[model samples]
Structure formats: structure tokens, C-alpha cells
Target chain A: MNILLRHRIILPVVSLAVLLAATFYMQPRAMSYFGLNLLFNLAVPIALATIAQMMIIMVNDIDLSLGTFVSLAACVTATFLNDAPILGLAILLALILSYALLGAMIHAFELPAIVVTLGMSFVWGGLALFILPLPGGVSPGWLRALMTVKPPFAPMAVVAPIIIAAVTHLLIVRSGIGTVLRGVGGNARSVQRAGWPVIWLKALAYGLAGLFGVLAGMALVGLTTSADANIALRYTLLSIAGVILGGGEFTGGKVSPAGAVIGALTLTLAASFLSFMRLSPDWQIGAQGAILILVLTARLIFSRKGAGT
Target chain B: MTNSMMLFSAAGLALIAGLAEADTSGKRIALSNNYAGNSWRQAMLETFESTGKQAVADGVVAAADAYTTSENQATEQAAQIQNMILQGYDAIILNAASPTALNGAVKEACDAGVTVVSFDGIVTEPCAWRIAVDFAAMGREEVDYLATRLPDGGNLLEIRGLAGVFVDDEISKGIHEGVAEHSQFDIVGSVHGDWAQDVAQKAVAGILPSLPDIVGVVTQGGDGYGTAQAFRAADRPTPLIVLGNRQDELKWWAEQRDANGYETLSLSIAPGVASLAFWVAQQVLDGEDVAKELTVPFLKITQDTLDEALATTPEGSVANVTYSLEDAQQVIASAR
Candidate 1:
């Protein structure tokens, strides 16, 4: 239990610290308030996305469609939320309900989450395409104002990650509902014996995941000031990688919202850092992958050392 | 003088000189496009549909059918082409998903006596006629305009298009080549805009604090307005922002021209060139000899022409000029 706890928090903190130090050393300006904002400006959406992925992982399920779902939400947010508020709100609510139904269906039918989501990605993407056939839409005035709000003390970019991580950590790690969701992942049989509906818990987790996905999509659209069906497509793999990089396991009810945010930040910073270093865009992706592998290896080593003790 | 304008005028003459060589009246034309995710593709489709209808009115072709696939898969596009062949289209104007992935289908269409012409994002099939603007020249022209605007050396911030794309690489190469000639200019910063307005705005916003005084900004299509917005939002003096052919950008440029006395050139691959492919197909069907490859000049819009483009351009649509048959003949002749 001690090893598990340490791995959950300590590994990600260490990795984040190391990355921060390296970035500051290479580009001192990144330490400034404005510089930090520029570096982390896009991290809020990514953090929300990682948390969404974390919720699904807590239920020991994966969502291959999370990225496209986020994109769909952005499409909805950009078009409906701006033009027809009532209709847009109704559609978004229906989307959340559909996610809950999807979870229930997955549990009842004994479907693999991967296959279900993989198929659903097309549905979500096609829906987004139907809504916004082209990559042009006006972001709602309020959302844009919210995204660009510059706090007096620090840029919202820097503050957003912390708030997102804290709130998600509290809800998913500290709350009683969170424990039930994780319990479902750990052992549905026991949870069922305890007179709890396993399917309900699973559905609840999926609903929460959908909520966060919507928030992520909206935040991204707010920042970018427009929406496209394929805009957030890169988030699918990135969110999964963030969860894993934060010491979350693929199996068991082992996931950390805080760690996932840190992992996302680490990854975002790595890209920005590389850009500041003036590396070719061709080399940036490879370099970011290398960083991921190195961090994972170090985490593995540290876990092994703790296990030996 | 813009070389393209000069070249275009010369081509216009050739087209007028060669107008009587072909008459295409009853050919069925089909437009097969790979994606419609961006304004560029949407504008291209609209242009093709409208121009094809015009061709029908002029007895240039019998029917013009357009098909667009949202999925950016080569197989999907190739399948669409095969179905078009099966549908008995006399000619297929294609904007391919890949450079070579559609070769097999294109070859089949050609073997079946179908005239195939690809434009914008074109194909590499030996049997198809390809129409494309010289992207390198566009890039070079962007820098050349910058050089003339800022004769003395100044820092240039290059907002590149999507990373790892062939067009992106080609344009970037051309920009570098153009910059190499002007000893006074230096590119101090670069970022990928992904050819989207909002993406470019966010990226430019992020990098602005880190960059020194930027004298000018160079970008591919779909991002110029966003770059200008970033500058305006940052309260920085708006530099010379080279524009692509989006109506939004052109409109914004006209506004800036009036308000801030801003002046800059606008250049883009007229999405209407898809219609050029249709016209080419018509010529081929009329038994006129056409080249396997055709290079079309990018439309260069100056202050004098900017208003005309904006006036005719529909709101929220890209500004564009279609090629007349006379102009089309000139384009075909330039290949030789």
C-alpha cells in the first residue's frame, strides 16, 4: 500500500519537477509569468481530457473515442451554444444521457470498451461533421472571455491547471462516490455482493467522463476561438499516455487525477520546450516520445526499488 | 510587379489566341474531392458546382456532379473514384487524398476512356492531368513582397502551415529560399498554424511575448486573419500580414486598409481552380490536345483588385477568381 501510494504521487511530482527545471534552464523566459502562460496556455483542455480518461480508467475501462467526443462537443459548443442556446443545451444534455446509456449497454452486453468506443468514434466524428461541415464557427462570447481572462497575479493559463487538477482530485479521489467507482473497477463481484448495482456505478463513471470530455472540448474551442471536427483528434492517444505517464495502470482501479494533470503538463511543456530550443518539428514528436519512455522507465525503476524494500 | 500577374496576363493572351481549338458541349463531369473539413475545400466545392452549372449553361458540359468524403482516407477516396467510373462519368475532376494512393483508380478511369484531371491537392498518376499552383513560387513571392516592403533587415515571424504536410514543407522551403536572396532579412521565429484561424491566433499569441520586434509575418492560407487578430489583441503594431484567399481575411484586410492605412499583397490558389479542372476535362472531351500536367499561377491581389474581390465575394466565403476558357488555354500552354 505504501509503495502504491508513493508511486501515485511521488513519481509524477518528481517528473514534473525535473521537466520544469530543465525547461527553465534552457529557456529562462519560461519562468516568467507571461512565458509560463504561453507554455501552458493549451494545457487546461489537455488536463480536462486527461481527467476524463482517468475517470474511465478508474472503472478499468478505456475510451478510444474520447478525443473525437471532445471534438464533437466543441463542434456543438461552437455552433449551437452560440446560435441557439436552448437547443444547444438540450442536445448537450442528451449527449450526456447517451453516454450513460452506452455505459449500461457495455455492462449488460459484456462488450469490450475498446471495440465499442472505436465504433462510436465514427458516430461522434460523423455527428461533429454533420454539425459543422467546415472548420469555421464563432466561439460564444462568454467562453472566449473566460478563456482569455488574465488574472492579476498569474496568467489563467498557469492557474487553470492547478484548479482543474485539484477539483478533479477532490471529486474522483476524495469523495465517497469516487471510491465506489474505483471499487467497481477493482472487483465488481464484491461491490455487487455489497448490494450495490455495478452497472449503475459503471454508468456513473461514464457519465462523469462524458461531462469532463464536454468541458475539455468547450475549453479548447474557447481558447482556439473556433471548432473543427478533427481539432482534438490528437488528444486520444495523448490522454491515454498522460494517464499512464502519471503512474496509472491499465488494469486494476489504480488511477490518479492529480498525476494525470501533471503528466499532461509535463508532455505539453516538453513540446513547448522543444519549440523554444528551435528543434525541427520533425524531431519534436520523436523527442517527446523519448521523454515519455524515459520517465516511464524511471518510474518503473523506482517502483521496483520500493518493492524490494 | 508580381510575376504571377505578368505571367497571368501573358497566359490570358494565349488563351484568347487559342479559343477556337475545342468545343466541349455534352460531357458529364464529376468532381471527386477527398475532404471538406476546411474553408479551402468547402470553397473549392462551391466553386466547382457553380462553375460546372455555368459550363452546362454555356453548353460546355452536360452534367456536373460533385462528391466529397469527410474521412481523410486514401481508400475511401479511391473507392469514390471507382464508383464514379462505374457511374459512367465522362470526366472526373479529382482533389486526391494522397499523391499516389489513387493511381490505381485513376489508371482504371483513364483506361475506360474517362478524362481525369486533379487539382489543388493533386495526384501522381501518369494517366491523369494535374493542375496546381506553384506553391514554392507562392512562398517565394511572400518573401519577395516582404523584402520590398521592408528593404532594410527586420525580424520575420513565419507562421507555417500544418507540420509534416508536403505543401507545408514545400512552402517553408520556398520561404527559406526567398529569404536567402535578401541579405537584410532574417526569420527569427516560426510556429505551425495548421492553416486554421484560431489555431494560428493562439500560437501567435503564445509566441509574441518571446519574439523581438517582428517587422512582418508570412503565412499560408487560412491563417492570415488570425495572425492579424493576434497582433491586434496584443496591441502590437500590425505588421505586414500577407493574406491567403479567405473572404474573412480579405474583408479584414480591406477594413485594415481603410482604418490603419495598411497595405499588403494577397495571394492564394483560387479554389475555383477545381472548375479549371472541369474546363480542362471539357477541352479534352472536345478532342483538343491537352498536356498531362498544367501549372496555374497563384492569384495575386493588390490594393486595386482587393475591393473588387471583396465586393463579389459572398459573406463568410473565400474570395476567388475563376479562369475563363481563354485563361485556361493560357494555363495549358504554360506547361509546354
Candidate 2:
């Protein structure tokens, strides 16, 4: 591989570095343990959710129900898990099973992934509304404690994202099963010709997505210490954007867990940075969108240059 | 135009009140709610239902019906209102989706001689009677309270409600207006909390690092306890957090005061105002003179009142004081 091709991650990495530098330059205290904790505390759940979306994207499928499913898990965590531990555990497991079943059903009917997930979003959202019905529930004490755990020297919020990325990268990039999953997404016919059950691979990918989505939901509850059925609805679009921003390709099999994590962090920080800069709430959404588009456009130019060579 | 319509309704009401033999038995009242996503809205719906049933028992109204449009859409709510009108309901108690989007439908209802009582997110139709707490006043009052606490002027983190929302805009403007009155208090930063506990907490957490020493926080409803929790979690000295009237927030503030001498004022639009709206509709149906616009006071929960409010408030409920039929009468009198 050429030098330019070898440094494929340089664009996203450089963009992330620049953003970090700018944020720290403006608010130097953000480099401190406490400051870092305050800044990145909410990113853990977002990173996990992005990874969930990334996994589905790896299989060339989009999970529109991802955010609602996370909300469902959070509702369960805040209500059933806090009040009735055993029942909550059962429901959470059942939720993951349902995701796997959804994947199998989609494959069986050769349905458009978008339609199926879109339809299921309501199903999951309805179930969430049924369970909690209100934006009020207490997360368990232990979970709350877990979210607020302060380590010496560096903040857990800062470290957890790196560890999450590394572990996901190890599982999906280095391991043999990872190859099968990506292969199924990239070229299902080729994978099937090699005696791999493409159907099972698709289901496993969805199952992994569900697992990560559950983690995201629990992490979110931990941070806020409460649950609402509609709290994380905005995450569906954000997670998708994170995946795309992180160098994840839609044609399938090309995704970087580290890039996805960085993408999520970048998006989270963009909003926080806008708030810090004292921009009006009306401009925050538009400003964040502009930043995402700008960064991605720069990355695209870099990729084009590399391809041209 | 709405003023003239209001005057017309007021005259009609006065005429009805003057007639000693006016009958209101077997009148139907319908509740049209937009969304049921929060505990406060659920509480509002519950109060509306209960108050309606009590009215039924007293033979003041024949039946009370409620329809909640799961989505927060003006078109959907307007459709429901039209349906209520077609059903020949005498009154429609509405928590509207938009301020002006329901005006046409409300006018239709008014034209059909249906008493339209709107509250919370109210309609702009002058023909419809509105009952709500003064939101801008709540914001200004919160800042006034904070100013007294911080006489020397200090940095304040403003946790505004949902972005682009009329309530958020009004209350935020009021906060700024109050802050303008006292130039010492500086708003270090501001962010939209979407009026949800978790969202407010997370948004606060994100911006805390960039902010200086925040002496106090002013917030809207559904956000107070979570803001307090965020401070507690960060291991920072809890500041003068002005609260919205959520029962959990009251409970938390009480616990804090008991444990550590923490003190703060709480204020919010009471969910029971729904019941007040109900009583007003019923009174209007009973041929009693009622004002077209009723501005109910928000619940002001202080250290002295916190205990009583929390004691009566059920778990998972907002801190509220229910208004009685007598209280409704007083409100009507005051409005007049």
C-alpha cells in the first residue's frame, strides 16, 4: 500500500485532534480531571450507541429503531430493574432476543431494512411508553454510582471511550468472527459460497447491535439517574451521523470502531462547545450541523486525493 | 379580534348567570390533550379525569371524555377537537398543541356554542378561555430570588427549557429581564434542557467545565432535581438551585436541608391547573359568570411550604396544590 493509502485514518484523526486543541485552547480547564469528566460524561452512552449503529451499518442495514430501543432499555432499567431486579433482567434479555428475531424476519421476507426498522421503532417506542408512561424513574443506586465513579489523574469518561473502541476494534477487526460479519455485509453471495451461513451472520450482527444498544441505554441512565421513554429519541439520527462521520461506509464491511467513537465524541463536543461559546439555542443545532458537514467534506477531499494517487 | 370575542363570551356568561333558572344537567365535557410523554402531562390528564367524574356525580355534567393524540401535532389535536364538536359536547377542555394552530378549530367550537377552556399550552383564540400560570413571571421571580441570595452579583448558569418553544422563550426572556434589573448577576452560560430531568442534567454536565463558579441555577419545570443531582455527582458544593415544582425535587430539597442545611425556593405551573380548567368549564356550563382568561398562580414551594406539598404529593407526581371549586370561583372573580 502507498503511504497515503496506509494513513487512511489520518483525516478523522487529524480532525479530532484539531477539535480537541481548539476546545482546550478556549477552555484550558477542560484538560483537568474534573473538567474532562464534566465534558465527556455524556459521551460514553453516545459512543456505545454509535458502535451499535456501526455494527448494523457493517451488515449494510440501518436500525431506525435504535434510539427508541435504547429508550426502552433505559425505561426498563429505571423502572423494572430498580424496582424488580429479576423481572427487569428478564425483560432486557427479551428485548435483545426481539432484535435478533427482527433481523431474522427481515431476512426471511427480503424486506427493505429501512421499512422494517421504521415500523419497529413505533413498536419499541410504544412498549417504552407502556412500561414507564412518564418521564420519571430512578436508576439503581449502584448504576448511578458506576456512572459517577471518579478515578485519580484522568477521568473515567475520557478513558472509557478509548477502552470501548479498543475492545470493539479487537472483536470486529482482529478476530475471525469479525471477518465473517464484515464479509456477510460486504459480499453476502461470496460469503455464502464459502459455506458461511449469511443469515446467521446477519442475525449475529443485529444481536451485537442490540447488546451495545442496551449498554448505551444503561450508561445513559447511569449519567442522568433517571429514565424517560422519549429521552434518547434524538440519538437515532446522531448515531447514524456518527457512523458516517467515523469513516464507516454504507456499501458495508468498511468501518472503524475507533473512528466511530471519535465521531461520537466530536458530535457531543460540538454541541458542548457551542454552548460554551454562548451561542443561542436556536443556532446550536444549525451550527453543529455545519461543523459536521465541514469536517466530513474536508475528510472527503483528503480521501479523494488519496484515491487519485 | 380575540378581545372582542372574549367580551362577547363574557356578556353571554353574565346573561346566563343573571337567569336564576339556568340548567346545566346532562352537559358533556371532553378533554383534548396533545401528548402524554411526561409525568406532569399524565398528572394533568388524571386530574382532568377525576374532576370530570366528580362533576358527573354532582349531576353538573352528563359525561366527561378524554382523547390524547400520542403525537405532538396541531393538526391531530385540531382533528380531535372537530370530532368532539361533531359529538355534540357542551364543552371541550383542551391542552392545546400550539398557541395559534388551534385558533380556527376553537372558533368553530365557539361558534357552535361549545365552551372551549384551554390551559397549559393554550390556544390563541380569543373565544377560548385560557387558564395558566404566568410563565414569564415565574422566570422573573426565580431571578429575583437568586438576586437576593447573591447580593454581590455572581456567575449563574441558566438552564433554559426546550429550545424554540414559546414557554422557553418567554421564561428565558423574563430571566434576562430580571437580570437586567440587577446587573450584578451574570449568566455565565445558557443551554436548553428540553424540560426533562435527564436532558437538563446531561446538558448541565456538558457545559459545567467551561463555566466559572456558578452561584445559582434557574430552571423551568421537570428539571430541578436532576440539576441538583448533577452538582452533587460532580462533588461540587451545591449552589442556590431554584427549583421547578416537581415532587421529587421537593423531596430532594427537603432531604438536603435536613442533612446539610440546604435551602432553595421552588416554583412551577401546577399540574392541578388542569382540574381548575375543568371546574371553570363546569361553572360556565352551570350558567355561572366566568372570565374568558384566568391566570392561575404557580405553586411557590419554599422551605416553609415544602413539607406540606411533599406530604400530600404522591410518588412519581409533581408538587402541586389542587384547586377546589370554591378556589375556581375566586379565580374567576379575580380574572373579572
Candidate 3:
């Protein structure tokens, strides 16, 4: 049990497995391939958003604008990307560069990340609203096809998250640059003393977060086939919750990429499970709260037990 | 005619129509609602459940299930719609999160031969049947009503709905058009209330100190009560505020009317339009020649009908009227 708790990924994995089993038990039809596709399709963008949030959290910063940033990206994708692909790609690239700049400014000025990102949330939301005020923009055909593609042996919903988890794990958990990046969060002064560029590392982390946020928005638009300014606003809270559920902490550089992906899937399946339970609408939201509390309590208990010995 | 008489006649017609053809007995229908945080939406869900239960008891549909996304996100709603399709529901009655964001999932359902009927928060997909309110007209009419009360049209405060929503833009456009036509009324200040009473109250309170004396407040429903509260809190004279058909708004209007004869207009989309969407989905599943688009008339309350509306509307709910099959057919025929 101590070993399992030490692994950190086991908690999220067990939570996801339990939720999946419950969902299938309630609605046996959900065990089929198409059923899994329908159940987990929306989890793709959510997983992406979670990874983006994890990136920021790993750097010991929280991004309050992740939701609006993703919304802005979706708006840009649906409008500019559909009409003029070159312009859209350029704008998206510019957004990532802006994120890097934001990180640099924060580090250079010693600005609070929460306050800065909160202010940027409004900026991104306003920009998204300006671009697609009426929520009517078509997604590009290729993006839609890619999102909805039915790869054999597993649905895109299942396949995409595994790929995201594996790739991010390789990049953030198994690389030399990743060590430097994590080092910045672990002990910035020590890392700077070690001759690593702390500001550049922070900028890289923010840039990667921006990239994942953009991908999340694009994947969302691809699935929805259109864009709206407020389309992915709930992603802010969901992504934060995903990171915490995946054993990522707020103050430390402790994070697990695979666990975060599993955490996203768990959150998605929890909703599905609740729906299949046919709880009344009044209790449905409350039941979701209860599920979150239950899982977090279990996590807390396990962690405490591991610490005591 | 009295409201009950009209309902009785509509039900009678529906009974006759039901005897004539009942091809939807085996169909299963689902309601994919995005949000239900407000009294209006709660009323809508309740109305749908009650009406759907009646239909099932009468063997109109085999099953009528309703699912609402916990988070009011288009992505969540799209997933809910797809799950409904996979669950083998023959039809889906949707209160969509966005006008266009659910089109992909909606199109997939259409391809699977599922009948989709969206109401109130309607979708823009061509394959789905839309039961929409003429919200712009509702907004225009608010100004027109105020025009009658204040002929010399003074400064008007515009309380809009959520920003960036299609409904908000349409209604605001209509209000602006009305202001253009009237030429006497000027909208001096505008604020987005997000169609919530508390939000409206806060926004109005924040802006009232800066504005000059306001004679009338033009609102997009759900904000009138809050605007009134803000006026009271600020010790300013209450303007002639048009109201949404929320029960609290109506009750407040009644109290003001009784105390000082404060006369005003109340108008909003009935929450029971979900029932209308349900019937439309059933009709489409029954292979009826239903049009892809239909308009639902917004419910309006005047000084004369205020008492009646207040009496019928439950406490903390909205004024509602569940549509019968005959009414659905009438709407379809009108569209044709």
C-alpha cells in the first residue's frame, strides 16, 4: 500500500478504473466500442487542457486564463483557420509567443502569476468575443476529420489521451531540459546558481502550456464543428481540478503527466457515471461534488498513511 | 379568451388529432438541456418531465429521458447528445449551449436518423428543427410599450443579457432599432446583466451613480426585478421597468401596482417551450411533414393580465404554458 501511494499514479488510475467499471455496470451498452467513443469523445480536449494546466502547475504557477485562452484559440481556428489557414497558423503561433513573453515579464517583474493570468483571462475572453461574437464559425474540414477519425482497435478518444500522456511524459519526465525546467520550480535560486537560465525555462514551460491550450481549443472546435467565445470557459476549473486529482500540487514541482491524463479521463467518466445513475437534476451537480470529495478524501487518507510510516 | 379555456380547447383538439394518428408510440425521446441554474430553466425541466410523463402514460413515446450537463459547456452538451443517440433514443429535444457549437454532434445524430428538435436555446444546424422565439421582436416591443407610457421618451437604461450570446445581440439590435424609430427615447447607458437577477442588481447599482435621471429601463427579461431593487437601494425613483415573466418579477410588479399603481409590461419566452420541442420531435419521428424552422410566440403580461399571470405562476418560478400536440401542429402548419 505504501509503495502504491509512493507511485502517485496508482490513485488516479484506480479512481478511473472504478468509475469506468461503475459506468459500464450501470449501463451495460456503454461497454461497446461506439459506446466508449460517445462517452469519452469530449474527454480529448479536456485531457489536453489538463496537460496544459499541469505544465503551468509544474512551474509553480497557476494559469487562470487557460479557459479563455483556449476559447480564443477555438475562435481563431474556426474563423481565420477556416478562411485563411496561413493567417490562422501565424496568429496561433503569435499567441504561443505572447505566452512566452508573458512568462518572461512575470519572472522579470516578479509579478504574481494568478493576478496576471486573471487579467489576461478578460483580455482573451474579449478578443474571442470580438472575433466570434455570435458563436457561428465553421471549423476546417481536415481538423474535423482528424478529430473524428476512427482508428482501429481503439477510439480516438482513448487513443489521443494515451498519445498525449506518453508524449508529455517523454518530454517533461524523461528529458534533460525537463530536469532544468523542474529545477526552476524546485529551487529557482539553486537552478540559477547552476548556470541554467531560469527565465528561459519558465518561458519554455509557459510556451508549451500555450501550445497545449491552443491544441485543446482546436480539438474542441473540431469536435463541435464550430466556435463560440464562451465555448470552453469551464475548462479553467476542470483543468485545475484534473491536475490536483492527478497528484499535482500547487507549491511544489511534483506532477505526473500520465496521472494527469488519467485524471482527466476520470473526471469525464464521473460525469458519465452520474448521468447513467439518473440522479435528479437538482442532485446531479451535488453528486458530482460528492464524487470529487470522496476521491480527494481517499487520496488524502492514502497520502497521510504513507507519510506516517 | 381565458387561459384555461384556450388550454382546454387545445387539449380537445389534440385528443382528436391523437385518435386520427398515433404513429410515435414506440419512439424514445430525450431532452439534452445545457443549463438549469435559474428558475426559468428549472421550470422548463419540470414542465418537460411532467408533459413527457403524460405522453408516455398515453403511449405517445416509449421513453422520455432528460439529461442536463452539470457544466453549461457546448462540449459537454455535444457529448450528452451523442450519448443519447447511442442510447437508442429516436429523437432528441435540445436546449443547446450555443447556436452553432453543437452542429457537429447534431449532424452526426441527423446522419443516424435521429430527429432533433431544439427550442429556446436553438441550434443552427439545418437538419434539426428549431422552435425559436422572436427575441428581437420581444425587445422592440418593450421599447414600444415604454413609448406609450412616456410619450416624450426620456433617457432609458438598457439591461442586456449575457454578452456575446446570439440572443443578446439580436435583442439589443431590436431595442436599438426601436430607439431609432421612436427618436424620442435615448439609451443613455447599457449593461450586461447575464439574465440573472443578482447580476442585474449589482450591475445596475454600479452604474446608477454615474447616470442621470432615468425615466424607463428597457430590459431583456430576468433583470427588471433587480433593476427595481437597485433603484430602491439608491433611493432613486423607480423607472418604468419592463419585466421578464419570472414569478418574483411579477410578484414585485404586483406589489408596486397595488401600492402606487406602478403599471408596466412583462414579457418572456415561456419555459414550457421544452414541451413544444418534445412534441415537435415526436411529430418528426412519426414521419410528419414538419418544417425545419418554427417560431414560438413569447408570453406577455400586461396590466390587465398581470393578476391572472401572477395567480397562475408558482412561487419562485416563471409564467409557463405547456404546448399540446394540437398547438405543435398549429406551429408546424404556420411555418409551412
DockQ of 3: 0.49
Report the Cα lDDT for residue A287, model 3. 86
- What TM-score against the true fold does each predicted structure earn? 0.52, 0.51, 0.80
RMSD of 1: 24.0
Q: Provide the global lDDT of candidate 3 against the true structure.
A: 0.89
TM-score of candidate 2 relative to the true fold:
0.51
Q: List the pairs of residues colliding in candidate 2.
A: B247-B319
lDDT of 3 by residue, B228-315 (tens): 9999999999999999998899999999999999999998889889998988888888777888989997788999999999999998
- Interface RMSDs of the predictions, in order, are 18.7, 18.9, 1.5
DockQ of model 1 vs. true complex: 0.01
Question: Per-residue lDDT tens digits of candidate 3, residues A29-88?
Answer: 788877888788889999999999998888899999999999999999999999999999
Clashing pairs in 3: none
Write down the C-alpha DockQ for each prediction. 0.01, 0.01, 0.49
Better of 2 and 3 by lDDT: 3
RMSD of 2: 24.5
Better of 1 and 2 by TM-score: 1
